[model samples]
Target: MPIRARGARHRTGPLRSPGFLRSLVFAAVAALAAVLPAPVGAQAAARPTESRPIYSYESAVREAVWVDTGLDADGDGRGDRVAVDIVRPREPAQQGRKVPVIMDASPYYSCCGRGNESQLKTYDAKGDVVQMPLFYDNYFVPRGYAFVGVDLAGTNRSDGCVDVGGRSDVLSAKAVIDWLNGRARAYTSRTGTERATAGWTNGRTGMIGKSWDGTIANGVAATGVEGLKTIVPISSISSWYDYYFAKGAPLYDGGPAELADAVESPDAQAHCAAARQKLVDGSPRSGDWTQLWNDRDYVLRADHVKASVFVVHGMQDLNVRTKNFGQWWDALAANGVERKIWLSQTGHVDPFDYRRDAWVPVLHQWFDHYLLGYDNGIERRPMADIERHPDQWSTDRVWPPSGTSAATVHPVNGPVPGVGALSASPAPAGTASTFTDNPALDESSWAANIDKSTPDKAGFATAPLTKDLRVSGSSRVSVTVTPTTSSAHLSAVLVDVGPDTIRNYAGEGEGILTGTDRTCWGVSTAGDSSCYLTTSADKADVGFTVFSRGWADLGNYASDRKGVPLTPGKAYTITLDLAATDHVVPAGHRLALIVAGTDNGLIDPPPSRPTLTLDLARSGARVPFVGGAGAFARATSGARPNVAAGVPDGTPSSPGIPVPRMAAQRLPGGAGR
Candidate 1:
């Protein structure tokens, strides 16, 4: 990664040895030490290193302040003040040694909680933060960096109504960045009239978190705020609309207002009731694109983003969904933003939970390069680190491997009516297959019986692969359907039919089994422990894996923003985009596509149960295959399943990936030693 001199105060000169850099730092500190503010025993300005800690974490300063956001979502007369908890090495303030900030702004800090342990913030007698959640405070503060945890407005110590992803939600976090730069006002206390300022350090900042916490990082970065150098958003949502809806199709019966109500602090309920009401009224069930969604959307404003982005997301994250990252990443690339990504196979999990040993060191280098302005060559490394299988990671210079292209594969009728084969050759024109709506059937049920005829769905499978075939990106299913009713719902599921032992994300633990053994991440304190319960991969033996899926309300066939009711027996062509993915089908596995109505639990059923006829010639999936159509054709042209050719049925069915060895080095956990 080429380093860009982002801030005016930071300079990116020619690369030299670490020893030379330290010497330069010492000389500068000596020349200015007389004029600089130095406490009784403040040491020479400390330099950050990837392997060593030079600052005293136990002696770090800890405090809390309220930054004023110029908004009144709760209809309160005064501007809302957002809570910011700070933990930093004392040397920054005492010795005039400035450091960059690593901040995680979240609404969950006080409500649902954060991390695998679900830890929440704790305060001491003076109302100063005694314990900040997660290992950021423990790890980074000892490395001469400040870790700031911010409570989003309407949650925790912040004052305002939870606006969901609306103005209050986005602006409150942005206000903290502004306060660090002396552009926004803050208070010593939530209701105090006295002012507070961040005078202890340089303003370069990086935001990171998972889920809603990470979502705020994206929102704030999109504001193009100065002093925000980078952001690492893990399992985050780039568009709130995408989170709850898919191309105008609502995944749940509820809307944004219900989410606002769930996370709203108890004290804020009364004041925020009207704000919640507005969310309900503004978001119509009709799935129309409203100002509310537009305001919450960061993709549209991707051009406004100035911060470099480090995106981390699970390929199978159904809650926040993969499209949020997919669309946002594309837009960022289009605008030439500096970016890096880590795509994992787990569903809605933090990398720290699964890949802790690797995650920590990489994260440290990323922050060191971007926030602390160290030329660590992290940016120059591969742009993507993707986990293609269980615990199997590969680095790529570009995602989708360089040669990936969309290849259309059509469904061909077999001797039986409903069951079909997928081929590169187009099916006969006007040929159609029919299936009745089965509101009870989900993707799993549809995929499990792909080769057999069923009333619930029309299934198509390719011949067993002769070689591994990889699908590297999002796919689209286009079909012309004639339905018995004016309104209908359609779904497409892509499955790898074979035997394999994979992460059991569908299980209660959601892919990880927490064990009694505790692994320490950083130093520990009484209020907060850096040691957490160790987790192992929860693997399951499975015959079929649903790798990608898509859903659509046929009424929004032409435009996601507008709905056009269909006339009975009239054919309408609709295309639905499957969630983004990267998966490999082993040689013996058959790649299958199942088309059905009502994904059941995923999306609510349409009012009418419509038996539909699909035009086979016009309907097919456009897949992003690694070697394009040629590779897909060669893989699927073999006469028999590769298993018959001595390929083992349990080729990739290993129990689980072995646990990585953890490092023993520790940093401070929280405040008190």
Candidate 2:
């Protein structure tokens, strides 16, 4: 057996015997040959009979590795080791050809898994990922790239307590990139007694994922790590504060402790109770920004990001909300990060499920151009992909499509919640509109009664448009209000008060549910399932759809961190903004603004209803008009729109798109986009 040639293999021995490792070295040489271009005019049979390849997708090396984050969250004294399971080409491992990495570091690996199909990792006898969740590993690993699945510290097999988005959560994966570039240390085992290294890597890497996984990508990229080249964060949060609160309104009933418990190790809660308690105490239920939230906010330090970014978010995503994407998009743009974007109408769904056929190839090209140094020309392509309808995608040169313009409109009060009109000019001086806060009613339900007298809310709008009016981007609201009570919370909504069949977003279930609906996305193994229930939305008649919304606590209006209660009957000026939008108010539809109390359905209900009076003469809403030529100027100037009763659609129209982009359509300072 010792007299063997370079390519010879021992017929009988341990799988990784000395003969096998040496033969693998030869196989690595053959893998290197796989990437080299063929020589010119040489006889095919006479080519160096290459034994090792430069790269081979199907025959790559697959194994598990541990990265030491250099932190001990549980105080056992050992470095909190992060588990980085890898699928790489063997040739790259043998020093044949170095490969860049595609990483999806997540806490979901052990708890729930990833993607719509919810695929989790499976292990062989040695504990390698036999079934990597979703399609990223299977599709990209075979294309001369290494796919790394990391178990965030404190979850799965990683050693540490889940610190949420704190140092442990963020720095754990940063250590992996550091190790790839030789800046940090890794070990062969969780015990840290043995050594391990990433000698096969090129030190360049890209991170991509959705929700918490994508949030990790954003958090890591914000650290300004040198080896991180790019990131693709889909439906992700740039600020954890935005996830749970708006202005001074808590979006959820429970505090961050519940969230920590939801994503962390079930048994490890006792160890991380202090960290979890910090979240509870910091999020004071009254909805104000705290140091804990600031630490978790990636947007604040986005200026430090050197990674090119790609963002994908759904407009109807109440879970993460479009604001997460909006604020982060603005910051990334302001910081001049190289970027691309995709805006969808789905609710908390991934693009792979919504745009299956086009997403994979586009993603493949994106990686090839950024990570592999390929001249794939993806940079020259359109920067935005927007959904005009479900599955009806259109590519645009820039988002907000160029030529968007903003116009200010004043509210003319009427008797009820949805009855008033929006005037081109300011309301009469000294005129004021009053309404009481009602915690029991939802926004759409409150808007449903245009004719009913309501003491709880006031609505104002413009007459039906003669032609389609496209409203894009966030709208700013400037108002001065006098409250009857010491404290009050204000909510504003921009409604398309037209007779059209809009999406059913009034309830918790934002999408249509299809019965007996079942479909498979990717290949499945014993350890993972790939099929999911098909969903469909059932459209209903509505007076109008609440396209954009905003919230503000009168007490917290002056400062997000500090609250100043109002003196009864003393008016205070507060300027807030509604959520961003890409909606089209059809011809003969009115653009209405509804000023109410807390959004009871989504946020915590206020203690009591406060009768509030708004100074209508000084209050108005600013809208981004992107309809066509002169639409913005006219809407702001002298356009006389007809205020007419809308006709119910004879047939159900496409679910009124609940959401949408950037460039030639960009407004001032990338607004509207």
Candidate 3:
């Protein structure tokens, strides 16, 4: 019953009992534990494995370092220093194992917070990060990865002026990536002379975030930073010009300067005043193309992107607008960058809140494959995951689906005298419709009673569809108009004219309903909880919905760079690109198009009001159909004369879309998230 040691004399007395053998084994384990690094938090220090956790979450190391950017945005005479808070597995670095970095460089860490809970980073007396705001650090650190939360220049703990997506904002994050790859310098303290290096990293990095944070990811990727392996930009901007203007039409009165002022910290405001003024002087409200806009336009530099891109956006996000992701996605495709995309129907909402069940694992696989060099084959899978309805998602081998093609539809005279019919064939020669420009009425006002004639807008509708028709991508309107004034503003909207239950974006919740119940994503600590409020779809029943919309300045019809007033009453042709969309017009539902002027809250109006006469024979819309023209033709084989009859009288309310980056401006001076 007693265990005997090799070559040792047979044990006598108490050593012969089984309890004594057990005591000896227990004592040996205790001796080994004392000599080795104490087992992490009540359990043995986890060892790296092909699958499962490799380290202890409780023992992850937390530290702060200030990365020095070469730019002097605040005119402080010294290069800007961006505060980078890092969380990594302590055992890996101690064991001489290097891990990849998952970074989120943002201007919102202290200003607006992050995620549904509106969490801010918490630190201890030593100024080391004790708790991070989001689940990135909690979920990935134990899995053999490092998470870095960076405060962009001029925000939070960083020292510089907020450039609002300009060079300073972009390069501040780039400097961190450069430091990881040994190309830039960092210090343990903000003003410390001593240098620090990222000896724990493998020199591979991935940047990710939502809104302004995500926009920084796009800007940094455009610089072609070598160590950045990929980026996941959600509801982000590709061009700051597009953020404030659309086709030579200003979307808002405030430009980059206002946004900069909104996010700059109180202590930094005086230092940032000159930088903010530069933003105002460089970005003219006249919508002229300038070097300033070129510096913030990432789409122009898509070819410079070597990092793989994972794009996520809401189709109904009027704040950032769908065009931002659409143009950026197209540019990335043209450059042959490895990419994936997720498109949702919600307005300005993050996928984590809407599709957390699926988003987390997909994101994990993406990072593991791209950042950690895992052979997970995520790149070989389908490229798109599209949310067609609330809680309903579908995957496609390619975005816009494979068979998408343009199908031309024109407006012709309907049975109702003034109401126009959208037909597959062009209208009769010499036919024309006229409407006066009204700056007061927006797309919502014109969307109502679309089957009836209105003085301010021209409405055209298709007959009740005999079969389901889907518009897969962006739509275009090429119209030849003769205006009564020298300059005019133009707007186009594609509407799904049918009763349906959709996300209640018009409500306070925007598109999702947050509940009292909470769900946890990762490990939790006293200062930070990985748990967050649960969310469900908030539905609203509506008679009709505006699925796609676009705006342009008639004076800038010839070029987006400059506006040249047209001769009154002379015909000029211009093509307007509708926002990219993927929507299904169900069988028995009608598809309608509305043409108007000055979409109120969306873009600034021109000084003159124009009554434009449209040449119907030369005016038509090119809609992206899933199966091209033939399928569209088959869906509407016979044109019904009165397409507008029997449609719902009630109109949908304005979808309460949030202002872009408004959440990030949650502080005293901020406005958008």
Candidate 4:
């Protein structure tokens, strides 16, 4: 259930550290260059010419391949290379012509002799071609722009090691940009004017993609690279530790194993299998939490990024959590950089569906505004544009802005507001909920089926909304939990349950489900229930938690049979922080808080059924709200009038918890109109 792209095949054997590929590229480039001939007057006649090769397009869609040459700074042998794919009007703009460039730096072998044809043939679940096809070029390319897919070093035919997250990746990206600009200059010289410019040569470049590619786009932007006008980093993490490891705990258990099992190639499978074994063997070199933090530069400090950004996350993404999006958003806001975010209800792969309709166009518009300098109304857009339950899009100037208040929803036995506080006492002694970790259940059972028959799951609901409420930011629940054993995992989910039916808004179709909108809005449409919305499963979200390891360590507290006896009558508080989102709770709808001993389908079921105790007094739930009294009054009445409006526009009210300045607000009388 975690958002994961289908794995690519490994060519030969287990992937040694990328250090070996670096050596290979260096050797191959040198050997090839040595045998090639030097052209006469090659140095004196250093002029740019349009090196046209094959080109094709149907209707407005266009696809072309051209070769660019430059000095190889790394001395790996091959000339600095640039292969660009252009799709747009053949004629230059009547005025100042500048086309935006959406650069996709592919780790798959996109260059070399394999070409685009070979890449598209690969298939994932659903039998549809898994890889992005060149025929798929029309989506963004034809919209008066160009899409450049760069084959990262050593992958296609490019030289150097395919460093995952090292210096090479950054330098190689810069090198590509330089080559592209040079190509534009050459074309201009040949045409006797700066008429035909390709890629980001004459304009700006915006990075966009999902999974590994998406992560790389962010990595490059973090370098503070110039010309990176803006970026749409979808379903990616800025920090590896927060992503691959959980609170310094290795993520090698259920989720990781399921991902490993999906790889079809013997080589790729062997590598993951080996890594898994090493983890099981407790090998020192297996790269644990400390090792990963030391080995990879995952943290994306606010001061490091120079480009404006639009981050997308999914609420139900079992792989990467909305928390990662919050981390990046907070860092940028703290740095005072222009930023926007979109939280979708779908999972990692669901966003890629052309049928979904909203996100793809938004991505194109983002690039159009930044790369092509088009006044496509992107700048006027809000900092966060999210779609809440049912279906709708809402915009806001800032994210979880100041003035939001935290309102606690506690379970009580008495009447409405005056019901008086439920006894500030723990559950009766010896009372607990127990469930077993059935091995027969598929790993994805938690997120796949939504019949409400799952035994290990528990649900709590809030009274119908008294007023229009926007629950944004992270949602937390404090429960007194004691695992039957010293070492056990606890999982929780915050769901928006309907009055009559249970809806699975976070589920998605086959393939990688990128949780972009769900991460920001936290709610999903009725039919789109394939994605799972929770932050406990993803490392990115946990990294954003306000509390440190001390707050998250439940410690095998539930290791006994009486189901981790709750301190007899004492109340212990366990926090279940749901994924972040901006959603509006209509006056009629109720919000459900779901807590489960296991992450059902997303992660491996618990080793055994553990008993957990609910201490409602010390344990309570807090949601982000925008309007109320005192401090939040201004935000609600002055800016967020929607809180008083009856209609829902997808944007959820802030939980009102003061989490710095990233809270939501509305203009008087609804400025959006």
Please give, for residues 1-673, the per-residue lDDT of candidate 3 as tens digits. Answer: 1111121012111133466466545544543443356655853442211222335667788899999999888887898899999998897678776889999988777767787666788899999888798778767776668999999899889999888888999999999999999999999999989999999999899999888889999999999999999999988889988887777787777778767666677757878778888898998878888889999999999999999999998888777878889889889999999999998888777788888777777787888788866555688888988877788877888987889999999987666555777888999999988899898777767776676678888888877777889898788898888999988888989988777777765455557888997766656666656667889998877767788988888878788777787899899888887888889888777788888888877777888999999889999999999999987887787645433554322223433222232222122111224
Highest lDDT scorer: 3
TM-scores for all candidates: the values are: 0.88, 0.84, 0.88, 0.57
Better of 2 and 4 by lDDT: 2
Cα deviation of 335 in candidate 1 (Å)? 1.7
Mark the 10 consecutive residues where model 1 has the least summed lDDT: 664-673
What stretches of model 4 exceed 4 Å from their correct place? 1-100, 108-144, 153-175, 178-200, 241-288, 291-299, 349-364, 389-391, 401-403, 411-459, 500-553, 556-576, 605-609, 614-617, 628-673
Q: Give the per-residue lDDT of model 2 (tens digit) for 1-673.
A: 0111121111111134576567656655444444665566643433332222123444556788888898888777667888898887675456556778999988787677676545677788987777777766555654557889988887888888776676778999899999999998887777757878888888899999887778889999999999999999987878888777777766666655665676676545657776667777887877777788889899999999999998998777766777888888878889989898888766666776666556766777778778876555576788888765545566767666688767787887553333566776788888887888887766765566533457778777665566677887777888889999888888888877666654454333344434465544333334433445555553455556777788778887688766766788888878766777788777666667888887666566666568999889989888877844367434434335432433222211323332231001111001100
Predictions ranked by lDDT, top down?
3, 1, 2, 4
Q: Give the TM-score of candidate 3.
A: 0.88
The digit string of per-residue lDDT tens for model 4 on 245-347 reads 3332223333222322332123234323444443234322122333324333434445777778888766544455555666667677788777778766444
Per-residue error (Å), model 2, residue 278: 2.1
Q: Which digits, one per residue and each the tens of the lDDT, describe model 1 over residues 232-320?
A: 99888898887777776677677777777767788688788788878988888877788888899999899999999999987766566
TM-score of 4: 0.57
Off by over 4 Å in 1: 1-51, 639-673
**Better-scoring candidate (TM-score), 2 or 4:** 2
